[model samples]
Target: MTKPRPPLSKELQLRVFRRDKWVCRWCNRPVIFAPVMRLIESKVRNAGRVEPLSYYHTHWTRDGAPLLDELGAVIDHIEAHSTGGSSEEPNLATACCRCNVRKSAASMHEWAKRPQRKPIKGKYGEPQHWDGLSALFVVLAKRDRSGLTASEKDWLRVLAGATADAR
Candidate 1:
């Protein structure tokens, strides 16, 4: 026989809401439902799998409409809770539904580390921004991974953390 589910307390509900800023913990989309207690329960139930059923409520439009007029994409937990993961911004990522299902039960770090082709050469002779934001997007778009030099990579990493207002 299955064990009875525990009731979610008001305090616990508030904690989850506050922790997520009353938004969908994965996509950062605001949830329309009040209390959001029910949504939390659904996510917990489907927690272990890569594709949780609860995602529809969080990632989808408030009226249950599809994102981008389709299922949109998948939301992934960079670190699984089973291995002492925290539900924080750094640990969440967006993936396509197909990719998420394909990576089920696999370690996220291992899955993300797979080798791929490098990005193509840029039309601009040099990275325009010198700031990290522009470089980071270039890093994300390029396939050749070989393009950016080590020093450039280091600079981009440092710049990403720099304040926009900083000179």
Candidate 2:
């Protein structure tokens, strides 16, 4: 059975968010800080209720611009507590609501290898690039592979490409 994760204090959440520069570590997307006062005013103006905000993932236009929406932020455990991971700062990172939900209880390396839908290019037919995922793969490929699983090793091999130094 998995142990219950320890509760994280608001102070600790703030610290981790700041440490990660208010950005989702996995997708490298900026966290949207919704202004509480503005929300309150909107609610008042809308008869004590406002249109529900989009707390889900963000969407980008074909031109590579964000859709001017808010993305909920979360602090994720890089290594899952179910797998004996800790709640220490080193194991914490800021993530968007989308990435956090998708990565629940999964290790970073495992989650990285999962296939993702390719984004569409702009009208001019510019190539769509996943710079964030590419950077993450490069970093993971360069890490020590002594304790990696077979699947992880295979992923590293593919990520590292033929030109990478022999392990």
In lDDT terms, which candidate is top? Answer: 2
Report how far off residue 79 is in candidate 1 (Å).
1.7
Tens digit of lDDT per residue, candidate 1, span 93-163? 44433344444445667656754223234465533222212333334423233444454344334434445
Tell me the alpha-carbon RMSD of every candidate: 18.8, 17.8
Q: Candidate 2's residue-wise lDDT over 64-142, tens digit each?
A: 2222232356778889888777898898888765677688888768887986323233466432342223335345445
Candidate 1 vs. true structure, TM-score:
0.27
Least well predicted 10-residue stretch by lDDT in candidate 1: 30-39
Best by TM-score: 2
**What pairs collide in candidate 1?**
117-143, 118-143, 118-144, 118-145, 119-142, 119-143, 119-144, 119-145
Clashing pairs in 2: none
For every model in order, what is the number of clashing pairs?
Answer: 8, 0
